[model samples]
Each structure stands twice: as structure tokens, then as C-alpha cells.
Target: MDINCTTYELEVLHKIADAADALKLPCYLIGGFVRDKIIGRPTKDADIVCIGDGIELAHKVASSFSPKPYVAFFKNFGTAQIKIPTPSSEGSDTLNHLQLFEIEFVGARKESYQQTSRKPMVAPGNLTDDQNRRDFTINALAISLNKHDFGQLLDPFNGLKAIQKGIIETPLAPDETFSDDPLRMMRAIRFAAQLNFTITPATFEAIKANANRIKIVSQERITDELNKIVLSTKPSIGFDLLSKSGLLQLIFPQMMLLHGAENVEGMGHKDNFYHTLQVLDNIAAHTNDLWLRWAAILHDIAKPQTKKFEQGHGFTFHGHEVVGARMVPKIFSRLKLPLNEKMRLVQKLVELHLRPISLTKENITDSAVRRLLFDAGENIDDLMLLCHADITSKNKHKVKKYQQNFELVRMRMAEVEAKDHLRNWQPPITGELIMATFNLTPSREVGIIKDAIREAILDGIIPNHFDAAHTFMLQKAAMLNLYPVQQP
Candidate 1:
């Protein structure tokens, strides 16, 4: 089968073939470039494998370009790379306007791994050996770049059929493949999630059998794969596979805790695990933000921890949001995720996930809306999206009622925001100003006055204007039997 190639790509391939010919070496375009081309996916990198010295061939190819691209060669790995700038459609000279495409050259080689480590011993080998070491069949497909057969596909493993069938199967025996490099297990799930494909039954069972081998892999690598899965169009597919394959229990026991629901006195709650997945998928439908999806994944994470059954009440997870928010940092640290603003965003969302739901249930008030705006600040919209996705009841009427109430709350929020202008709002009075006005040191009285002013504004007893806050501050200070040292 022939793969479609753009004019520029064909020119680059010809140059590579010319270089290999000059060196009397055989070369082919292999792996993701070939696979993605067949599936009509946009790819930015090309992998070229040659039977002779890949670094030498890469240097030769680089010299053929007008402005020779720099060649970065790794002698230990027998690989080299060249990044060439693709002229913009408008042919702008601005550096930012140009797109760079990476071409990686590697020599065909075989690998053997010891039982204790994922790192494999490498040696120069033939094309068949290189294909044999591939993780999956679809990824093993190759296209010859030789002048004799410019775009000929080499598919001894029937990888093209697997691509057509939408299947993810190891090129070799699944057990041997996974046992050699356990990280491939995560790659398998990632591919399944990305392509929305199915893992063959035999391949899946092999993953389950070798799931424990994942321990040998580093946390950074594991979390990298996990993030890719989380960013897929529908992430729940990957998580469900992880759970069924027993990898979730090993990698993330906290999520596993959300799996089962219990009964007490003929009362039971919906399975939090499935509910979390539904919320994730719902948020996925609305936004592609990775942190927001993470918030959905963790919004109800503490339900299992805080679950309680009372005699009259069915189930109560009164403080799950608070608990879950507190759990975010530790989970992120354990998973080797970023500890900066991204973690803070997820934590803040988890803490406030229930605020909009509570507003929907209660009488909509300006005070409540103002408080939510102040607390959520810039993330109010995201918080609302989370709350909307949180409405996952089986009863259609109940869901509709909640949705209608949410709309009412949203309308009220807009009115209050337009009138009060309280998004990311702070009180007009400052503690330092209060202290300065009262001729006092940093003390409890200053804190009390600041809190009073803030509460008065949010409670609608005073306007957010400086004059109203100043008057309220003076009134509270008088009540405290204090007088301003200076008059304005």
C-alpha cells in the first residue's frame, strides 16, 4: 500500500534516500510517521531507520539543505536528529512564523533486556530485528524511502490490517513484549484511549498478568502516560481499562477506594467511581482543560472516606469536598505531577465544587453570589461548569429541576456581578489603612474592622464603594469604643 506524502515531505524523503544511496545503506521511514500518514493524522516528526550508520547518513542529508540544519547525534544510542524549518504559506521571514519539522535517524538494531530492569542491551541488527522489537503492530509498519520503491510499505506483521481494524496488539507475544519493557503497558492503554481502539483480548490479559512489572518504570514516565490519557478526547476509557486491568489499584489506590458502594438500613449511594467518570466525561464534553478534567476526576474522591449513614438520613458526605481538596497536593506529589499553579487550580476547584450546587438548592441571594464570586475569583465559570457536570442523577426530572435551578443561580450571579462588580472583589478598606486611621499597631482590632467591612460589603449592607466601606468602618469602630486619631 502507498502512503500519501506532501510535496515537501517527498522532497525530504528523496534527499534522505540520496544520502543513504551515497553511503550504500538501506533506509526506510518507520513508526509513527508511517502509521499516522496511513490514518490521515497530522504529524510533525519523521523517524528514518537505516541499516548503516544513521548519524553519518543524517550529516550527509543535513549538508544537502541550502541552509544546513544542525545535526544532533547521540553516539551511545546510534541516533541523530535534524530540525528543518518549513516555509510558511505566506513566506514570512519572521522566525515565529516558520514551522520546524524534526527528522530522526536511527540504525536498525535489536535489543535484549534483563529481568530486573526496563533498559535493554542494544546491538546493530537487521530490519526484521528492529520491527520485531516494536511495541505494537500498528507502530511497526514502515515505508521504504529507496529510489527503487519510493513509497512502498513493508507490512510483514500485517500492521496495516490492525490499523484498519482499529486494534492495539503487540507485534510479538504480549507477555514477552510487556515483560521486557513494562512502560509499554501504559503506552498500550494510551494508544487505545487516543485512537479509541480496542485491545485484543489476549493482549489485554497479558497486560493484566504483567501489570506488576510497571513498578520498574519511573514515576515520571508513568505520570507522563497518565497525563496523555487524561488529555484524550474521552479519558474515562483509559481509566476504566486501567481499573479492569488491575493497574489502577497498583498505581492509584485512592481512586480505587471510590469503586464500591455500600448499603445500610436499605439505603445506598451511587458508586462514586462511576459517578466520577461520568463527571469527567461531562466536563470533557464542555472543556479541554486538563486541570479541569483533573478536578472532575478528584471532585468526589473523598466521598468514600467521609461516607456516613444515619438512622434517618441515607448517606452523608458532608465534608468530602474539603477533604478532597486537601488530598490534591499529596496526590499530585505522589504522582509526580506539577506542584505549581496547576495543582493549586485543581485544589481550588475541588474545594469549591459544591458551592454552585448549594446555591441551586437554596434561595438565590446576592450575598451568597457575592461570596462565591469573591472566593472563586477568576475561576467562577469553571466552577459552574463543574457543578453542572456534577448533576448526574438517574432521574430525568430531578436532573431537569437541578439544571433549571442552576440557570436561576447563573442569572442571579450575573445580576449581582453587574451591580456589585464583585468578581475577585476585595473590600474597599485595607487593614493598614484602618490601622493608620485609628493610630493603632497591627492588632486584633484592625483585623476585626477589616473583616467587618468585608462582610458588610458582601452582605449588601454597604456598597463596594470606598465611601460606604469607610462609613461602615467608622460605625464598627465606634461600637468598639475607638475614635479615629485623624479626621479626613
Candidate 2:
């Protein structure tokens, strides 16, 4: 009640307070729910830190609702959670489809840690003890839900003032805090990026000093935090902080390799690291697709390895797109990211990012556009977006010129796609049909004919039709000293 809540939210809190009163327990809304509400950020999940048995309070609260909410409790962790369904909208016939309000209940506890693992040795404690264990001051703010101080705000660590100033600071000494749970370091940066806040100088310095301790955390947890950073409105902030803190080298060394620019013969290239971040920001402004943003991040990942300075050209990352595509799987594997279709989408975008831009510079050809459409397939638009974002030239006129060229490429694609339908194009002539016509098994001749037919269609030599491809197939077959057998 200390923070503004919707009518339904207040009702749920009143129920929780009623339940706690009946049980003779002190309960408070704590953690992100309190912080987000105070900062005017929309939040659904709330954490209830109770002075007594949290699981019992959860069950007691669940019984108050009409359709009893299920109390899922983990005895080992002494925590419980319930998701209360939203009341149906007025005059609606169907069931409530809105997201349930998720509340996690846990007894106030103090924690001690070992050098080997972040798994804490826990024991029951008071609210002050629990607040002392929070990773950041902003997250430690709580709202009392007891009868005596139901709407009272508790900012024991001056969390409200920290929130007001938009700063991230740990309640305890940051080194002790981070060493106890190294994941908190990642969380600190993530909050900074998410809230557009600054990490207190001392806290940030502690993060740098204990950056190596991040190795003790699991890859999955690290990647999870990294993904949160990437999904934030301005992810470059987080990555920059990570790089400055030296955490990037430990957690993702491949990206760290992109940190510097090199100079040769009085010619230097733009720093690929900052260039990548600019591209990421550019793409983020256009789309919230995480994979597309990831594509922007990795579009130039192989630049460091492929960097070359020709006699005339200052710097050239020749074939970097191909090399970057090949590196995607390895990066994905190391980051503990999903190696499924999502990763493939990012890989495809990274590989094809240069294709659309190349088209903009040259005399646009239908065949070239068709090939790009075919290669990029369903992801053509996304690939185009990534390419546009990749143009990080600081010259305003140069950027404008490149964008105009990109517009031309997009127009060409539209024309070619409408006429040829080459997006996600499939070859009209199949290897099986070629083999059957030539009366041969799966041999080199079949593959040769199939490739030729596909190239012919992409080149606009033959219409994308089975009959034209069939005739073209026969003509090419004869050139190879092969003839189709007579059919019945």
C-alpha cells in the first residue's frame, strides 16, 4: 500500500494483509516489485518476505480466493509462490486471459557463503537481515503490509534516495557482496542499464576488482543476465560497463577481442567494438527483436581476425561475414545461448548482413536482388535492417547517402520479388527429376543440372516455372554429353 497500485492490486494486497494478520505474521512486499512500483515501472511479480514460515502464509492466502490458487513451495529453500488470477472484466463471457499476479513468499533469512560456490548457507532471520543481503540498495526497499504500518515505506539503506538519484549501490561493502555471490556483479550492471542509472563509483570499482570471481558462476546464469542486458532499451551501456570492468574478457572473450582499433601507415580503422555497439543501438531503435540485435552485435565479430591493410585501402575485413557466420555456433555454444532456430536466425543475419549493403553501391541488377532474396528468404527484411544499422559512418552526409542507396536496394527487391517471387525460392527443377529424365542414379550429373537450373532462374534467364526449367535442363544435359531417355 506504500506504493500506488491499481484497484485489483490493492484488493490482492488487502487479502495478503488479511491473511498475514490471521496468521499473526509480519509480511512485507519486497525486492523488484517495490522498486519498480516506486520508479513507475510496470511489474507483475511481487516478493513477500515474511518474518515467520513463508510457506504457511502462502497456503493461508491461497485459501481466501474463490478458485484456490495453488501454493508451490520449495521446502529446501523455504520459499513458496502463488499466481492469483485477475478478476474477469465486466460483462465478459470467456475466462480471464490476463497474466496472473505472481507472488513469491519467503521467510526472512541471513546467508553465509563458501569460497567455492555461491550457494548460501541460510538461516531464519528478520527483515533487516534479509534487506542486508540484497544485491543493490534500490532492490532492498520494502513496504510494510502489517496492520500497524500497512502503508509505511522502509528504506533502511537509504534506497529511496539512491532511487531518486538513479544510482546503483550495494547495502554492504561491494567486494564482500560480490564475492559472496559473483552473479550480483552482473546484476548490478544489468540494473544500471535497465534503469538508465549509474553504478556508484565505489561499487563499480569493487566490481572491477572482483571481476574474475564471475568465473565461479554458471554459464547459464551469466548468459541469462547478459540476455537481459541485450534486451534493455540501450544495451551498449551494459556491454561498455562489462568491457570496462574486465568482466567481458572473462565471460565473453571473443567480444572482448573487438575492443581496440589498430593503425598502420598513418591510416586507422574505426574501433570495431564501438562500431558494433553503434550498430546495435541503431538496430534497437528499429526493432525489439533480440535476435536481430544479436545479429548487429555479431555482424562484425570476425573483423579482428580478418583485418587486413592493403597498400591503398586503409583496412578491409575481407570475407568477414563468412568467417563470422562460421563463428556463430561456437560463440553460441560458449555463451550457453540457445543453439536452436533463434541462433540460426542470428547467424543467417550476420552472414547476409553485407549482401544488401553491397547491392546499394553497385548498379542494381535483378539477378543480384533475386539471389539476395533467395538467400535471405523469409529473413530478408530483418537482414536489410541489420545492414542499414551497420552503416555507422559519422559523416552525416555519408550516412544519408548510404541510407538513400539502401532505399534503392529495397525498391529493387520489391520489384524483383513481385515479378519473380524469388523470396525463399525453390528450384523448379529437382535432382530427382533430373536423374529420372537422364535415366541415371544420384550422380554428379543430377547435382550439376539442379545447380544450373537454380542459377538460370536467379539470373532471369528462365522463368521460375517447371516447364522452362525442364527444357533448360535438357539443353544443359546435352552439353554434358547426357541425353534424356524416351518416356512411354
Query: Which 10 consecutive residues of model 2 have the lowest summed lDDT?
Result: 86-95
Provide C-alpha RMSD values for all models, in order.
2.0, 1.8
Best by TM-score: 2
Cα deviation in Å at residue 258, candidate 1? 0.6
Task: Tell me each candidate's TM-score.
Answer: 0.95, 0.96
Q: Can you give the lDDT of residue 253 in candidate 1?
A: 92
The alpha-carbon deviation from the true structure for residue 39 of candidate 1, after best TM-score superposition, in angstroms, is 1.4
Off by over 4 Å in 1: 90-98
Clashes of each: 0, 0
Q: List candidate 2 segments past 4 Å from native.
A: 87-95, 436-439, 480-488
Question: How would you encode candidate 1's per-residue C-alpha lDDT over 90-175 as one tens digit per residue?
Answer: 34443332679899999999999999999999999989999999999999998887878877889889999999999999989999
lDDT of each: 0.91, 0.91
